[model samples]
Structures are given as C-alpha cells and as structure tokens.
Target: MFMRGKCIGCGCCTSRCNADALLYTGEEMDADKVLDEVFKDILFYRKTGGMTLSGGEPLMQYDFSLKLLKGAKEKGVHTAIETSGYYPGKLYEIAKYTDLWLYDVKIFDESEHIKYTGVSNKLIMENLKYLNATGSEIILRCPIIPGINLTDEHFEKIAELSASVSSVKKVQFMPYHPLGTEKMKSLGREQKYENCEFLSRDAILPYLEKIKDKTDKILEIM
Candidate 1:
C-alpha cells in the first residue's frame, strides 16, 4: 500500500481480485485499494489463512502503512509484512498487525550493505532485534548476490545472527538471477551486475559449512 520506487505499476493484482474492491490511482496507488483487493480473496484467506503486504519497501510510506495495517486487522485478516527491516520506527508501528514478518537480511557487513543497497545496516540490525523482542514470527530471507557477500565469512556472520535471534523460525537463501535484466533495459537503466554468475551448489556449500551448526536452524536454498 505504501507505494514507492519504480514498480511496473501494473493493475494485474487489482484485476485478479474477485472482491471488486481494487482501484487504481495511476502512478501512486492507495492503501485502501490494496486492502480491498487483498480482502477479495477472503475465501482463500479462510483456506490458506492470511494476506501478505509487501512492496518496494512498505516502510517508505510510514503513515499509510500504519493505517493500512490497522484497517486489515480490524477486518479480521491475518497479516504479514515482507520488508528489508531497514526502518525501525515504522516497523514498530506496524508490528501489531503483523502475524508473520518476512525479513530480508541482505548483507553481513555494514559497508557492503551500503555499497549494493545504498543504505547502511545499522537501522536494519536494530529493527531485526526489535522485531525479535516484539514477539513477531520471523522468517529471515537472504538474497545470495553472486559477487557480493558470498564469502564464507559473510555466511558465518549470518549464521551467528540467526542463532542469536530466538524469533527466527527459518533462514532462506536466494541465489541471484537474470530475471530483472530486461526490466532494467526497458526502464532505460543500466545493469549494475551483468558479469556476476548465479551461485552454484559448490560455491554455496563452503559458505554454508561456516554457519551450519550455529543452531539447529532450518537452512534452505531457493
């Protein structure tokens, strides 16, 4: 609902909603519209059990996120938020509506985190700890960018962090892909990581070894 960044802004999601509750606001959509569309699959909600709120970063638009989440809860919709855990204050406000928190732990080192994501990990780390303390169910998601933070040391750090957090129910590793390459060209933007290869099992196993026994944790490669 808190729309920011260069999304395709396609109304595909709105059209798929059977509830007839979705509306478009052009370049910027509304939280109300998102809630409406999501609730359309109330029957599916009854079956699968919840709705997810995710975007470029829901925390980017704080006020709308709070209102959107509160509205969803009032309607008895089980809620989850997928975020990078980069904004603590906003994350705290939305924690109440969140039944599950899908958090992306992108990088281990602060400097490298900034280099690729153009942001520091200080706030992200703070927010992760806060969410863990707030009793939110957490799934730690990691995008294993090929040339960035793909070392044994980085995985060790990640394992330590995962073991330290009592709320972390799982750790997911996602390898880089060229899925967004054409999108960059279509959008008139240059690809920053054209030379990087997708991570291989051989390349990843060593890193995983460094963190394997930190906890009896669920380690998945996707």
Candidate 2:
C-alpha cells in the first residue's frame, strides 16, 4: 500500500507505527561524535582499512562530511568516498581530505544516462574530470546491470576513461543483484529489477576480458 502511493507525506503513519521500523535512519552528530563511533573499529581498520563515506550521497551534508573527513585525516586514517560526482564545487573543496574516490559513472552517454538515472550526466562528467585534474587517486566504479547497462558500449566507455584519465588508477565493477527485491516487497513496493537475477562475478567475465584488452589499469570485481 505504501508503494502504491496510498500513504500521504504526513507524519501520521510514523507516529502510529508500532514496529519502529520506518523512523528516520539519520541522527544529529557533530564530527567528534561521529568519530567516537568510528574509533570503536580502530583495531579492525589498522593499515589500509579506514573510513569510506557512502550515501544517499554524502555531499548532501557537505559541511558535516568535510569536518568528518578532516577529523579522520588528522588521525591518520585513509578516507574514501563513494560518490556520483553530482555535487559541483563542493567535491573540489573536500577533495584534499579524500584519499581515494570510488567514483561512479553509471552510463557513458548523456542521453542514456538521463533516460536511466533521470538526471543529466554533464555535471557528473565535468566533476569527474575536475577531480582527475586534482591528481586524486580514483577507482572508476561502474555498475553492470543485466538488462539495463550490461552492454559492450558501456564497458568500452569505462575502458576509455581508464585509458584517458591519469587519475583513474583502476576499474571496479559493481554488478547488479536482486538483493533489494525482498526489502522492496516488504515495503509493498514494486522492484524495478524483479525479474533480474543476482549478478555473479562470472557474469561479467567476458566484459572483463574485453576491458582488459583495452586498458592496463587494475581491475576489481566487487
């Protein structure tokens, strides 16, 4: 019923919810407070292991994210961010504090990108180039969705970026899976890829071979 748009945006449902499952997932935390939580895993994040800020788009909270990254850096922890490269000047402002960028390029073509993601890829492409200019280490993260973007052209475009961009030190493939279908169903929402199967590492084997033939950059399947 929720996914069918039956529930209005009012707070009635949340106020009445007994399970406490749909409450806000975020909390107010200053950089220090967040760091307190992070340091709990200090032993586990010994050497190359450190904080990786993922999102809903971390740049949405630019000031907090910057402060958090700054605090982590001061403590000598390697910092990485998984981002869509959508935020304009903010990325450059925080680039120095970010040790690595798990930058996403969902689709290479602007039209196709807008068709699938409902946004222009122009800013994303620009931000990526700008980030590259900053000499930041980047691992190009590409999602290989079976029916959506599991195509030769998409892989080729990714290969092109690795070959042309000096900062793109490697390529990482994030294959699509139906793992979220159960959650979507639980919420009474329709799953977009309901018919799609989990993408095994072997599903991208041929594309990997194709990309390998195009660039010498390191490749990882995640």
Candidate 3:
C-alpha cells in the first residue's frame, strides 16, 4: 500500500489511475517472506549489511515491523529502522531487537514543522528522547530541505542533539536530491520540491562547520 518507492519514468502507467485514488503499487509481503528475502543476502551482512525497515513510517504497521525485527534478531542478523519518529508505537520493544535507529530530524521549530509536514513535532521529539534514554544506538539523519528547513537554528540544534544524546552514534546530513520530482511528474502529480537542484558537498560544508565545534560526534554528509 506504500507508494514511496522505485518508479521508472516510463509514463506508461500514468493514465491508468482515476481521480486521486491510491495507487495500486507495492506487492504485499508478510514478515516471513520478507525475512526470507533478507536472508538471501546474508553473505553481504558479514560485516556491514543488515536489515533496515523503512517506511512511509514502518511503525504504522506495528505488528509486522515487530515480527520482522524479532525474526531477524533470532537469526543473528543485525537490525535497524528508518523512521519519522512521528508514530506512537511500542518503542521499547522495537528497541529490544533493533541494533540502530536512523531517526530523521526534518525540522527544529514546532510551528514550522507543523506548517511543512502537517503535524506537530512534539511526538517526534518525545520519542527521540525516550529512545535515547533507552540507550538505543541512533543516527540522526538530518535532511536539509532547501527553502524550508535549511536554517541556522536547525543546524545548531542538530549539533546540540548530536553532542547531548549519548545514544546518537553519528549525525548524518542528507543533501537535497530531486529524485522524486520526475516520478511525481510521471504520475501527473506535483512535488513540493519540484525543480529544486541537487545539493553539492560544497553547499553542505558551511552547515558542517557551524555544527562541528558544538558536537564531538562523528558527522558525515550523505
């Protein structure tokens, strides 16, 4: 049911849909099937590779996500999740099986976050704090959305959180990429960051310098 994935810009499927209906994309896979797929690549997981549950917010499907992490852990495979931190799921239980948390820090200001993402950042902030308290190994994946959240206050807080949170293993700055723009256009829809240019490492250096002094944690631009 998730539409947030790979789409070639063929435009063949664009006209198939009716008025704003949900796209019938992404095959359904139960936890066991998914684990089977994950295990197929177990050889690569010898050192660096592992299972990461991503989403339109994986916590939205609490039962399936739980089953997945539990199964992966039982088989001695590493586990991680990339989450928005916006869902109210059983974090402690998920943390028990998860080896790392790739938590997104979209924006720092509450009003601005609500304006941009259509929700308050209260829950995200709360869950992040709770996760840190649980000693969950975390990577703060901060995306620098152009013309929206790329601000001084945002960078400063990213540094502060990186330095203060004992569980944060690293602060990763994700540059803006126009990967979704073409996919949206092919689907006869418009994206918010349409026409935005991809950011270069040179562009992220200033922000990195801003946070470098405040945080001793490892920082990398992706």
Task: For candidate 1, write residues 23-107 as lDDT tens digits.
Answer: 6655666888877877887777765677776888877877887788798788887788889888846466678878788899988
TM-score of 3: 0.85
- Predict model 3's lDDT versus the native: 0.85
**The 10-residue segment with the lowest total lDDT in model 3:** 1-10
Q: Is candidate 2 or candidate 3 better by TM-score?
A: 2
Predicted structure with the largest TM-score when compared to the true one:
2
The candidate maximizing lDDT is 3
Q: Estimate each model's TM-score.
A: 0.80, 0.85, 0.85
Model 1's lDDT to the true fold?
0.80
Q: Show model 2 residue runs off by greater than 4 Å.
A: 1-26, 43-46, 185-191
Q: Note the residue pairs that clash in candidate 1.
A: none
Better of 1 and 3 by lDDT: 3
Question: Per-residue lDDT of 1-222 in model 3, one digit per residue for the tens?
Answer: 436356664544645756636345566789999999999988888688889999778899988999999999898888999999998655888889989999999988899888878899999999999999888799999888778767788888899888888999998989998888888786667476775688877888888887798998999998
Per-candidate RMSD, Å? 6.9, 2.8, 5.8
